[model samples]
Target: MLVALLLLVLALSNEVRVNGERGGRQCGANPSLKPRPHSVSILEFGAVGDGKTLNTLAFQNAIFYLKSFADKGGAQLYVPPGTWLTQSFNLTSHLTLFLEKGAVIIGSQDSHHWDVVDPLPSYGRGLEVPGGRYQSLINGYKLQDVVITGNNGTIDGMGLTWWESFRSHSLNYSRPHLVEFVASNDVVVSNLTFLNAPAYNIHPVYCSNVHIHNISIFAPPESPYTVGIVPDSSDNVCIEDCTIATGYDAIALKSGWDEYGIAYGRPTENVHIRRVHLQASYGSTLAFGSDMSGGISNVVVEDAHLYNSKGGIEFRTTRGRGGYMKEIIISDVEMKNIDTAISATGYCGSHPDDKFDPNALPLLDHFILQDMIGTNITIAGSFAGLQESPFTNICLSNITLSVNYASSTTWNCSNVFGFSDSVFPKPCSDLDNPSNYSSSYLSMLSMKGKTMVSGSVSMKK
Candidate 1:
C-alpha cells in the first residue's frame, strides 16, 4: 500500500511539472480557434437584438439551419454588438458561437419561458430544490469541439427575481445557470463576462477536456448560492486566468451525491486550476465536495490569490458521503483578509435521500499544501476529520498565516494527522510535528496509532 501510494504521489508530481512547462496561454496547447468554413449572423435569421423581443425561436432556427454544416467543417454563429434577449438555447456540436464587443445575450426574466429538465443522475434531484431545474441560458450536451468565445461579451442572467423567489421559498424548481455543458468534450469558453446568474455562472458536468480561461464571473454578494465555476463529475478540466467573485464558493469541484453518486461510480480526476483571483463573500474561495460521493482526486491548484473570503480553502463532507478526496496539491497561494485560511470538516451539506450508507466512509489523504502565505486571517486552520476515517498524510510546508492575536483559537484540530513544516501561529499538536519532508516524498499511512506523512518526495522552498 505504501509503495503504491508513493508512486501515485510521484506520478502526480511529474504530471504537474509537465503541465506547468507547457508553452503559450492555452490550456495544454488548446489549438488556436480557426475561422469556421461557414458563418452566419443572427440578423440573417430575422433575429432582433432590441433586448425586448423574445428571440428564442430566432436563435433556435439559426442553429437548426447551421446543423447542415456539421459534417462540412462545422460553422460559426456570430452575434454582433447588441442586447440579444432570449431564454435557453442548446448549442450544436462542432460550432463556435462568437460575440462581438459590446454584445450581450440576456436571459429572459420570465421564469415560465425557461425549459425545465430532469435532475442529474448523480444528484438524484435538483441541487437546491427536490425536482427539475430551469435550463441554463446557453447549454451544450453530448457535444464535441464547441467554443463560446467573444470579445469580452457578456451573458447576463437577470436573477434578482429568482433570488427573491428562492429566499421566500416560493420556487417550485431549482434555479437556472448562466451557462452549462453536460456530457460534452473538447469545449472552450473564454474572453467573456458572466453576470447575475440565477445560480452558477459556468458549470461543466460529466465532461472532459474542458478549458475555461480569460473570463470574469460575478454575482451580487447578497445573491444566495451563486457559484462562479462548478466542475462536477468532470475530468481533464483546466480553469485558469480567470477572476471570479461570487456570493458562494468561487470554485467547487464535485463528483456526485450520496447513493446516486456512488451508483454512478465515476470520479472527477486530473484537473488543474491556476493563476486566478477569487473572492467569496459567504463561502470558500476554493472548495471540494459536500456532495462528492462519486469521489474527487488528482487536482492541482497553484499561483492563486484568494482574498476577502468567508473561507479560503475548505474540504466538506458528511457522514453519508461515500467517496474519497486525495492526491491534491495547493501551492503558491497568497491570501488576504480571510475568515478561515484552511478548514476540513466532515460535516456539511445535505443528503439526497434516506437511502445513504452510514458506514460508507470518505477517505481524505495525500493533500500537500506548500508555499502559502496569508494576512489578516481570523482563524488560521481547522481540521475536523471523522473518527472512523481520520484524515491523514496532510503535508504542509512553508505556510505562514498571520492570524488575529485577539482571537482565542487560531487553529483547531481533531481526528487528523500530518507533518507541519514552518507554519505560522503553529498548528495543533496533532499535526505540528514536522519531519524533513523537504527531501522526501510522502504517502498516506498511520502506524502505531500515530498519524504522519511518510515517503520519499522532494519539495522546494
Candidate 2:
C-alpha cells in the first residue's frame, strides 16, 4: 500500500496547483477593469495554457474577433493564469490585452514561425544588419489608442537561441525585439515585466504620444544588445518610474541611422525622462545615440539614479551621423560606481556602410548639466567635439564627484565651448568664466528649476 499512498499524495499536489492557478486570477485592481460590453476570454478560443500547446491560432482568432468589433468600443482580451506559448501576433486598434497574475505569454523559439517584415524607410535596413527584420512578439503598426498593460504579467522572449545565433555570427536577418510599435500613435505600455528580450526590450519607432511607466525590464548581465527602452524617431514620449537592468543602454534615444536618415528627416523631440533607476553591467545608464541622424532635440532627463553602471549621461554620434543634438537638459542625477560620469563624443560607433557621407558632421549644442553628484567614478567627464564642428553653448553647474582611480587626468575637454560654476576637480579652460555672463547664467538656472518641477508633475500623470 506504500505505492498507493504515494500516488494519493501526488494527486493532492496536482489539485492544489490547479486550485492556486484558478484562485489568483486577479493581481490587483486594474484601472481597465471597468465593465466592458465587448469582452472575450482566450480560453473560449481553445487556448490551452499547459505551457506546451502552441496557441498561435487561438490568439489570432481572438484578435480577429476583436477587430470585427472595432467600431463598438473594441474588445478586451483576457489572458488567464498560465504559460501560454505563442508566436508573433499583430495588435489591433482600441484593443486591450490584459493578463492576470502568474500569466505569461511566451515567445516561440522556432525561427520559421516568425514573420519577416520590410525595413524602416528611415533606417533603410534592419538596425543590426541589412535586409528585412523578423517581427516582434507583439507587433503593432499604424494603429491608434493601443494599450498593452496588465497586472504585472510577463512577456518572456526565450532569447537564448537568438542570442546564440547572434554570437556565432550566423544571423542573416535582424533579431526581433520583445514588443515593438511601428508607426503607431497613442500607445500606453505600463504595469508589465519584460524578461530576456532577444535584442531590445521595447522599441517604439515612428510613433507619437507614447507613455511608458511602471515597468521592469530585465536580462542577464552577459546578454548582448538587450537595450531597455528605445524611442526611435518618436515624439512626445515620456518614460518614468521604471527600473531597467540590462546589458546595453538602459534608455537609448535614437532618430535614425546615417544618410538614409538624413533623407527621411524626421526628428525625435519633446522627450521627458525622469525618476528612472538604472543598473547596467555593460552599457550606459542613459545614452543618446550611436545612430542619431534624423536629429534629436528638446529632450530632458532629470532625477535619475544609476548603480554600478558602465557610463552615465552619454551623448555619442559618429561622423557620418548628420543629426543635430541640442537643447538637452540633465539635472538632479546621482550615480555610484560609474566608469564615466558624463561624456559627449563625436566618434563612438561605426557607420552602417562605407557609402555614408564623410562631410556629415553632427551638431551638439545647448547642453546643460546641473546639480550632479557621483561617487567612485573612474573618469569624471570627457567632452570631445569635432574640431571642424565644435560644440557650442554647453554649461555645467553645481557638480560634485569623487574619483576612485589614482590618475592625474580628471577632466578631458576638446573642441567644446561652455562654462562651469562650482565644479569639482576643476574644469577645462575651454569653459569661460561664469562671472562674465552672470545675468544670462542666472536666468538659465532659474529655467532649469522650473523645468524640473514641471516635468515631475507631468510625469506623474
Candidate 3:
C-alpha cells in the first residue's frame, strides 16, 4: 500500500526538461542536460514568514538582494513551506521559483495597493537595453532559462474581492495579472495550483520554447471574470496536463493586432495544447479571439476534456482582428453540456482604434475536428461571417452527439456519424458579400445511428 501511494505521487509530479520543438521528449530525466548551474534561494535573500499574512518586507528584501545578484548574473530563488503575502514578484534569467510542499504564495487583493510600472524594461542576460530607458514593473527583460514549479504548493491571487469590483465596472482601470512571463524564452511552469487571479491567470507574452504542465488553475465561477492563459502573440509554447476553470476563455491565443501585428512582424504560432481539462464560467472553453493581435497558425489541441463550459471549440475574429486562423487540428475531445460545439466567425470592414491594423482573411480554413463526443450542444455547427471571411476546407469526422431533438434543428452530413434531426445547422459561407455568393448554405453535418436515437434514420438534404 505504501509503495502504491508513492507511485501515485510520483505520477503527479511535474518534472519537465528541454523537449524538442514538437519533435522530442521532455528532457527532465535526460542525462545530456545538467541541473541549473547556480541556485540563489529566496530564504537566503531575507524572505520571512511561516505561511501567513504580510511578508511584504521579506519579499522586498529578496528583490533587492536579487538585484545585487543580477549585477553578476542571476540565481535560482527558492520559497520553502509558508504562506507569504505580497504585491508582485519579478523573475530574471536563470532564476527559478521553487515552492516546496505546503508553501503558499498569496497576493494582496487591494488593486490600489498593487502598483505597476509601464513598458517593463528588458532584463536580457547579456543584451543591453537602451541607455535612457529603465525597466518596467516586474522587469523580466531578456529573461531565459527559468522554471517556476510548485510541488504541492499553492499560489493564491486573492481575487474574489477584485472579482466583485470587476463585475461593477467592465472597463474601469483593471489590475495587473497574478503571474506573467513576458518576452522570455525557455521557460517552464509546472505542477502548481494557481487560484483567484486578480486578472488573467497566466500570461506568457512574446515567449519562445515555453512549457506549462500539470497546473490546476481556478477562478470565480460567476460572470465577467478573466481568462486562464492569454498567450498574446507568443510562439513555440505548449500547455499540457492542466486543469483550468475560469469565467472567460479557458485558453485564449492573441496574435493579430489590427495594424500592430503587421507592423511588429509577429504572429502567435506553433502552439500545442493537449490533455487539458477545462471548466468555464461564461466564455468558450478553447477560443481564438476576435482581438488577435497578429495572426496565429500551426496550432493543435488534442485529448482534451471539457466539463460544463459555456461554449466549446470557438474561432472568433472581428473587424479589428485581421489575423487568419489556419492549420488547426482538434482530435479526441470529450465535452459535456457546452453552448457551442464549434463556432467560427470573422471580422468585417475596419476599425481605426486598433493599433495593429487587420486585413481581410479567411475565418478558418484547413481545420479538422475528429473523434469528438459531446452532449447539450446548444450551438452545434460552424458560423462564418457574411460580410467578413468564409471558412474553407472545414471537416468534422467521427463525431457523436446525444442532444434533445426538440431543441436541435437537424443532423446529417458528409463524413459525420451519430447526429439527429434536432441538431441545428449553423450556416457557413460568404452571404453578405456583394461580389460572392449571397445565398446561405445551412446543413446538418452529422447523423445519429438508428439504435442510438429512437431507432430511426432521419435523413436531411
Candidate 4:
C-alpha cells in the first residue's frame, strides 16, 4: 500500500470536513466511472475554498482526495495559481498536474506535515520505519503515463528551513528527497523551475522511460548539496535542456554497493544527457560513481556546457561495489573553470584485496571522448596504477585543450596505452618497460608534439 492511501484513511477517519466535500467521493461524486471519463478539475478547495487564495488545510484535503484514484486509470489535477501550501502529495497513474500560469505549490515548513505511514514491503528490517520513511512533495509510484508540467509557474519546496537544518547537522544525518518517482514509468517533467530543495532536487529512482526537460534548479552556493538529478540505476532516462546551479553533482547514479548485494546488480544504463548547462556544483557536471554498488553503462552525454564546476565528466568506482561502467560516449563537451575536464578513479587503490580482481570485477571498457574543448583543467590526468585496477579499452581523440593557467599535462604511463600529444611524465619509462605490462599494451601510446602542456592529458586503452 502507498503512503498516500494511508494518509487518506487517516484524513477520513478524523472526519475533517471542509465545505460540501465528502470523503470517499470522486471529484464530482460519480460511482459509475469509466476509463477516459470527463476530466475532473480541483480548484474549489484552497484557503478560501473559493479558488481565490491558498487554504492550506483545504489543499491538503484535496491531495488526500486525489489519492483515491491511485489504482485507477487516467485523471488530471488542475491548479490555477495562488500559493498552495500543503504536505507531500502522492501522484497516481494516468494523472497529471497541469498548472495554469502564475501557479505555485509550496510545501509546508514543518516536517510533521509530511509525516505519513511507511509504504515499504517489510515492517522493521529491510528499511527504517517502513513506508513512513519515504516522503516527497510529488511522489509518483509504479504508475505509467504521468506528466507534471507548468508553463511559467514554480514548484517551490519552501526548503530554506530544511537546508539550514541540514547544513547545521552532521554528515550522518539523513534528509528526505524532495520529488521522487519510485518504480514508475513514462513520466515527463518539463518547462518548470524547482527551487531551494531540501535534498536532491529531482530524483527518478528505479524508473524507466523518464524524461526531464527545460527545468531550472537553483539552490544556494553555500549549501552542501548532493545531486541535482539522480537517475539511480534506472534505465532509458533522458535529461535535456536543463539548467542546474547547485552545490553538488548536476546528475549522478547511485546504488548501495556493500549495502545492496549482487542479486541486484543492475546498472543505470541507456541514459542520454544532452544540452545541459551546469554552474558551480560541489561535484561533477555529469558523473557516475559515489553509489556504484549497482554499476552503470551505455551512457551518452553531448552538447553540455559547464561553468566553474568542481569537476567535469567523472567515472568512479569503489571496493564494496560489484558494478561495471562501460561503453560510455562523451562528445561535444565544452567547459570553462572546471575542476577537471576528465577523470577516472577507482575505490580499490594500487593494493589488490578481496574486492580487486579483474576476473570478477566490473570492467571499464569501450569509452570514447571526442570533440572535447576546455580551458584550464585543474586536475592532472589519472594514469596512476591503483592497488586494485587500471583503465582498459578507452579512447580519447580529437581533443583541443588550451591551458591559460599552467603548462604541460601529467601521466604515470604504468597502465595506459595509446596516449599522444603529451607534455609531462618526463622520461615515459613506464611505457618502455614491457615486462611490467602486457605485450602490445605499452606500444600503443604516442605523446610527442601534439599540444602544449598544461595540467596533463592521457588516453587509456
User: How does each model score on lDDT?
Assistant: 0.84, 0.80, 0.59, 0.58
Model 3 / residue 31 / CA error / Å: 12
Query: What ranking emerges by TM-score with the best candidate at the front?
Result: 1, 2, 3, 4
Candidate 2 C-alpha error for residue 200, in Å: 0.7
Q: Report the lDDT tens digits of candidate 4 across residue range 44-124.
A: 553532323435565456656665665555656677756666677677666667766777777777776665544322111
Per-residue CA lDDT of candidate 2, range 1-461, in tens? 32332233233324322322231111111123343458888999999998899999999999998998777777789899999999999989878888888899999999988899988888888877789999999999998777887899999999889889889988778999999999988777888999999999999999887888889999888888789999999887778789999987899999888998898898887677778999877889899987789998867676789878888889998788999988776777999999888989987887767778989999997777777899998888898999988887777777898888655688889998877766786778887444333344334433543342233211111
How well does each candidate superpose onto the true structure, as a TM-score?
Answer: 0.91, 0.88, 0.74, 0.73
The prediction achieving the highest TM-score against the true structure is: 1
Q: What lDDT is obtained when candidate 3 is compared to the true structure?
A: 0.59
Clashing pairs in 2: none
Off by over 4 Å in 2: 1-36, 435-461
Decoy 4 TM-score against native: 0.73
lDDT of 4 at 412: 31
